[model samples]
Target: MFKRLLLTLAFSSSIIWFGSCAQKSQTTADQIEKAKEQHAAVVEQTQQQQKLLEEKTRKLQEENQQLQAQLQRLQEEKRELEKQKAQIAKIQKFQNVKAENLQSAQCEINPDLGVPLNPPQAKPGECFAIGYLPAKYKYEKVKVLVDAGGEKVITTPPKYKVVPKKILVREESKKIVVIPPVYKTVTEKVLVRPATTKKVVVRPAKYKWVTEKVLVEPAKKVWKRGRSFLTHAVATRFDPNTGDILCLVEVPPKYKYIKKKVMVEPPVVKEVPVPPVYKTITKKVLVKPAQTKEVVIPAVYKTVYVKELVEPAKVQKIKIPPKYDYVTKRVKVRDEQFLWVKVLCKDNMTKDAIIKLQKALKSKGYYRGPIDGIYGPLTQEAVVNFQKDNDIPITPGAVTLKTLQLLGIK
Candidate 1:
């Protein structure tokens, strides 16, 4: 009864240990699956973000192209405006200077320098500069007969020519002559793209996984006991080397198989010859020479003059009258004026805004310094020049809104 109980106890202990081991293995598998799920989610999110970035970049490029086109049109308009402003300035240049040695009867306004005479009537939120109204003219063509028809007399002159006779030379003469060369077309080859030898892997280095046995534990000798079959007694020996029944015991070497790679062939390089290309061409060659031939002569005549009526004798009417044309004359319509204008100054701008402003000015060929996002002397000067060139209100040390509009920045 006790032996049976001992076997039952040993079996129960083994079952409990095996159940715990299986639960641990199941937990490890679940962790591995969870890790795989997390990795996949991360990969998907990365791809989505990349796509978003690409879309944004494409949209930015399209916007940039549109801005460039708009800038081009603005620059063209600015140039035209600059031309008109220059003409106006030229015409109105005398407004700022007073006349010298003038009598009171010749002048209608006072010569005082404090206020300008006949200034332009400016409206609210509007600016004005000194500009002259160019002269206007109306053209008229007068129809006055320059030439009147009258009778005319014509006369014919006489003509004459001289004649000559040719005498016959010796009999017929023979002369040697050379003939031009002839040509025939032929086909030939020409190398357009040169022939070159290149390295190629004719037989690449090959490898294969081969199973090989490796020794883990080597063979070793150990002492063992010998038992008597009749008495069933344990044999006790003092010296392991000296025993009553000498037995040889050995543990065979343990071996294991593992996959390994073995090279089958090595890489190779070979030189190969390439054939040259050909093309057909036409050429000239000497085919025949000049031969002697007979010649013939003919009579020649001299020039002569003959009396002929080249033009009929008739009367044509002719008359002379007055000539007339229309001429243009300038007539002043309005006087130059001066007024105040609005502009951008240091109070309403930041570094980022300045950077964008600088870029716009640079693209329009107004600014030449680096885009350092600084409202420095270079930027201010560029703004003034741009404003002047585009016919915007040129307030010193400030940029007019009209200038920004012309630069396509607004």
Candidate 2:
């Protein structure tokens, strides 16, 4: 009995173990299925995320390409702007050079007439010796000198006279006569005519009646259904199996005939002539032509005293001495001569020097004008007076070296 009891207990334990193992196996399988399902769901979600990323990347790439194109265009524009700037700069440089050249060319210096040093200096033709310099120079030279001097004497001859003698004259008188014109009565005949006008007539224009025809409705295409003669069946129009007809029908337009007047010929004009009227009238006519008669005239004469030249006009020679005087004259020994000498000219002259000159003149009571820096007429006159008073050689209207030295201006 105990062995049987043991066997039963072992069998019961074995069955319980088997059942637990089956249950655990089933739980593990369920967990594994749930894990597989979750993994598949995550993988599908990852795939969707990757697709979205790819689409975003594609859009970004397209935007980047467009931006790059814009950048390239901007770069090209920048290059064009730089080129234009360079060209403008080059043009400005050329203009500057041209302006400078024009300024220089316009300010050309004259070589013959040097700039004036002082206002009072004698110009080229005034005095025996005049001072001037080469153009734009600081030195003086005598440019003129008289070549000759002379005096002339004149004489006049005595006057001549003519005399006339009187002779006997006679006077005469004569009787005069005149003729008068004569006229006679006369008669004349003249015709008087009057102007006449002719009558003119214009005929009315002629016309004719005509008729014309016009269309009111145009031709049209229509569809009609009919029974086929071969099949004896009615069908839709334009069907091939069914007997149908497509017909083009022209509907005549309704028109009415009416009479219309149209001018066939223009009007005609006729003119009738009328004879001119005339009338006769009486007038004065010349019978004998007018004549002029001459009257006798008597002549008178008278005698008068008259003067006549016995001798013809003749010139009498009278000896006249020439008028003479001991006149002093300055004669130039040499022609115009030039010699270079250190001098102050306009190019090197300063306002200070001019002021000093004016002051000096004023101090010596030679100048009565303002002490302006300009060497004007007043200063020139002062210089001349000073030179004259100091017994300095006077170069007419010129500021000479001797003059300057005497004034202590050198």
Per-residue accuracy of model 1 over 1-410 as CA lDDT, tens digit each: 99667555655664575457557644654454456556557657866786787688658855765665556556645765675587557544533232221112123444342234433464555432222223232334434332232433322223222222334434553432222223454555444336776677777888888999999999865445554332333343444466465334565789999988988776787877665533343333446532223323223332222233444544444442333323232223433333233444445567777888999989888889999998777886687677555545443334556666777766
Residue 314 displacement (Å), model 2: 99
Q: Which residue runs does candidate 2 get wrong by more than 4 Å? A: 97-410
Q: Over 4 Å off in model 1, which ranges?
A: 92-410
lDDT of 2 by residue, 1-410 (tens): 99667555655664576468557644654454456556557657866786787688658855765665556556655765675576446433423332223223324423343423333444653322233221111223332222122332222222222222333333343322122223343444333334555646488789888775554555443334443332323333356775455333333456655667788997676657656543343333445532223334323232222233344534444443332223222233333222223234444346788788888888888988987788776876686567546644333234566666777886
Question: Residue 76's C-alpha lDDT in candidate 2?
Answer: 50
Per-model TM-score versus the true fold: 0.24, 0.23
Best by lDDT: 1
